[model samples]
Target: MGRLNTLDDWLNYQENLHFQDINLGLERVKKVYQRLFPKGVSFKVISVAGTNGKGSTVAFIGSIYQQSNFKVAQFSSPHILKYNERFVINSVQATDEQICHAFEKIESFRGETSLTYFEFSTLAALIIFELEKVDIAVLEVGLGGRLDSVNMVDNDVSVITNIDIDHVDYLGNTRELIGLEKAGIMRKNTPCICADTNPPASISQYAHQIKAQLEFVREKYASDIGLIGKHQQQNAATAMLAVQKLNKILPVNTIQIKAGIKYAQLDARFQIKTINNKTVILDVAHNAAAVKVLSAELAKQQCSTIAIFSALKDKNISLMINEISMIINQWLLVPLDVNRAINMKALSNEFNLNHNIHVCNDMQNAINRALNDKQYQRVVIFGSFHVVADALKILIPFMKNNEEEIL
Candidate 1:
C-alpha cells in the first residue's frame, strides 16, 4: 500500500482506514468533499434511497439520460462484480487509472479526518463526475440516507422506491423509522417522489417539515419492461416521475422515457441465462422483501428449480428463506467467506426440517451439483450480492460462448 498506485491497492487501504465498516455520518465526507469541490458539483444529481429497487431506479434514470444523448454518471453501492461497477459514466465503468487518481486526490485532501470505505468511494464518484463534466449523476444511497456520505451533496431530485423491514440495526425495525431515514435525501423545495403506494407517515411528515415537493405516486408504469417482476413497473414509474419533475432542466420525451424504462437492466436482479443446457436465474434477494418479489417471479417458471443461496447474518434469513421456499424445489446452501456472512452450520440448521437442503463445499460445488441434478431443470442463484458475484465469476467465462439473455 506504499503509494496506492492501483485501484485495488487504494480500495484495500480504504477498507482499513476507518474503524467501522459503516460509519453513517457525513461530517468527515463533507470536509473532504468541500476540499475536492468548494463550489459543489456543477451537474444535476438525483439521489435514490430505499431497501430495494435503488439500483434499478438508478439504472432507469441513467439509461434514460444516456439514451437522450446526455452524458450521465451513475454511482451505486456494493457492486456485485467489481469496484469499477460502482462508477459508470455513459454506461462505461471508470478506468482503473482514473479511479486511482481520484483516490489519491481524496487521500491528499482528507488529511487527518477519517472516512469510511463507502465514504471514499462516494467521494471518488463525485470527483469523477465533476472531472467528466457529466450532464447528470444518479447516486444510489449506500445505506440509510440521512447520514449516508452520498447525502452530503444537495441533489436536484430524490426518489424513495419502497420502505421495508431491512437494515434494522441502523435504520430501525419499523417501516416508519426506515421511511424517515430514506426520506432524508429530500431537500427543501426539491421534488421527492415516494413510489411506495402505502408509504409510512414518517416520510410525509419529514417531507412536509422540510417543505419538499413530495409526490406519492401509487400507479405503476403501464408498459412492458425489460426487467422482470411487477416491482420493476413500480420502479419504472418512480424513475419516470423523477424525470418528469426535472423537465425544465433535463427534458426527455415520452419515447425516450419509455425506451429507457424498457431497456434498463441491472446485473443479478432476476437476470436469466442459459448455461450448459440448463436455465439459470440470478437475483440479489438478500432480504425478505426482495425475496418475496423474487419468489413471485420464480413462480411463473414451470420448471423445477434449485436455489444456490447464502446471506449475511444481519439479514432476516429465516424470512428470506421462507419467502422463496415454496418456489424453489431444492436448496444448495453455499458458504460465503465474508466476515458478516452467516455461519454455514447455523444456516444449514435453519433448513434442518427441509430434506431437500444440501450443504455444498463451495460456490463452484453448489453450481456443479445444481446443474448436474437431473430432477431440477432450473438453477437459481440468489440471496446476497456476494453470492451472485461468486456465481458470476464462475459463470461469466463459462457463458462467453453460450447465448445469454436478460429477463
Candidate 2:
C-alpha cells in the first residue's frame, strides 16, 4: 500500500476510524498492537500518564536520554502546534514522510481490528521508534491509562504526574478515582513514580497491587527547581527523582541528568515574552486545578493582568473563572474553533464575576485588544490549548515583525 501524501489525506483517513467515545476496554487495541508488534518489544519504553504535566515530564526524560548520547524517541498527545509534534526522535520531529510511512505500515498490520485515532497514532509512533532503533522511547498516555493504547507496551519506568478532577465523565469525578485510572500504567516489578504532593489513596494502592516499586515526591526524594510556581517545581522534582531511579536501571549518568534538567523546553507553560514593549504570557490552563496555578503565577508577576481566555465545554469554567477573577483587570474571551470548545456566551455567563469581560470571536482581535491596552503591563493568553495555539500563531509573527523593525 502507498503512503498518505497530503495533510487532507491523513486527516480523512483519521476521520474514517469512527471511534468517538473514550473506550476503557483495551482488548481490541491490544489484539491489534500484539499482532503488529509482538510481546517483549524492541525498544525500552517509559510510559507517562496523568491529568496534567505528562507532556512536560516526557520531554524532560527524552531530553536527558538524548543528552546521555542515547537515541531517544518520544510520543506525546494533543499537539499544541503541529501533528508532527506528537513524534520526536533525538530532539527532532519525525518528517511527514516518516509519519506517513509508519501510518501505512500500521494500516496494513491492523487487519480487522478497529483502532481509535489516538490508538492508530500510537501504533505508528511505536513502529517508527522500533525502526529507528531508539535506546529509549517515552510515551504519554492520551487519556486514562488502563485502556490508553500507549499502556499496551510494558513500560520500563512508569511516571504518573499530578492527578486532578478533569475528565470526570470517563475517569470518574473524584481525585482518587482519576488517580487510579492514571496509575493503571504501572507494571509489575517496574519502578513507578508519583509527583503529586497529596496523591490520591488509590494511586498508592494501585502501585502496591501491581507490585511496582512506588517512588513518591517529598518522600523518596526531593529538589528545589528554579521554576516560578510550586506545581512546576514539584513536577521538575518528580521528573528529577524518576531520572535518578532510572539511572540505576538504565545506563544514564549524572551529567546527562544535570544537562536534561537545565535544558528542557516546553512552550506555553507560563511562558513570558516581550513583543512591541508589551509583556505577554501564554499558558494552557483549561481546568480549575490548572487555573489555580495560573492564578498564583499571575499574582506573583508585577503588573495589572489583562486575560485573553478560552476554554473547552467540559471544563469547570466557573471554578476556573472564580480562581483568577480577582487578579484580572480585563477579560477578552475568544472562541476556539474546535468541536470541544465552549461557546463564548456560555463561558461569559458562567463567569458572571464582577469584572469587565468582552467576547471576541476572532483570536487576533482579542490579542490585539489585549496588547493595545497600554495600562495593563501583563497580558495573559490562557485557557484551552486551541486558544493558546491560536494566540501563539499570531504572537510569533507579531514578534518577528517587531524584531525585524528593530534591526
Best by TM-score: 1
- Candidate 2's TM-score reads 0.94
TM-score of 1: 0.98
Error of model 2, residue 138, in angstroms: 1.1
The digit string of per-residue lDDT tens for model 2 on 165-228 reads 9988889999988998898999999889888878999988988887989988784223433234
Candidate 1, residues 1-407, lDDT tens digits: the string is: 38766787888898898899988877888999999899999999999999899999999998888779788999998998889999999899999998998988898899999999899899999989999999999999999899999999999999999999998999999999999999999999999988988899999999999999999887889986877888888999999999999889889999999998888878888888988788999898889999999999888867798999999999888888888888888899999989899988989877747648988889999998887888888999999999999999988877897866743
With a 3 Å backbone cut-off (N, CA, C), the pairs that clash in candidate 1 are none
What's the alpha carbon RMSD for model 1?
1.2
Each model's lDDT comes to 0.90, 0.81
Give the clash total for candidate 1. 0
Instruction: List the candidate 2 regions with Cα displacement exceeding 4 Å.
Output: 1-3, 219-228, 403-407
Candidate 1 segments whose C-alpha is farther than 4 A from its true place: 404-407
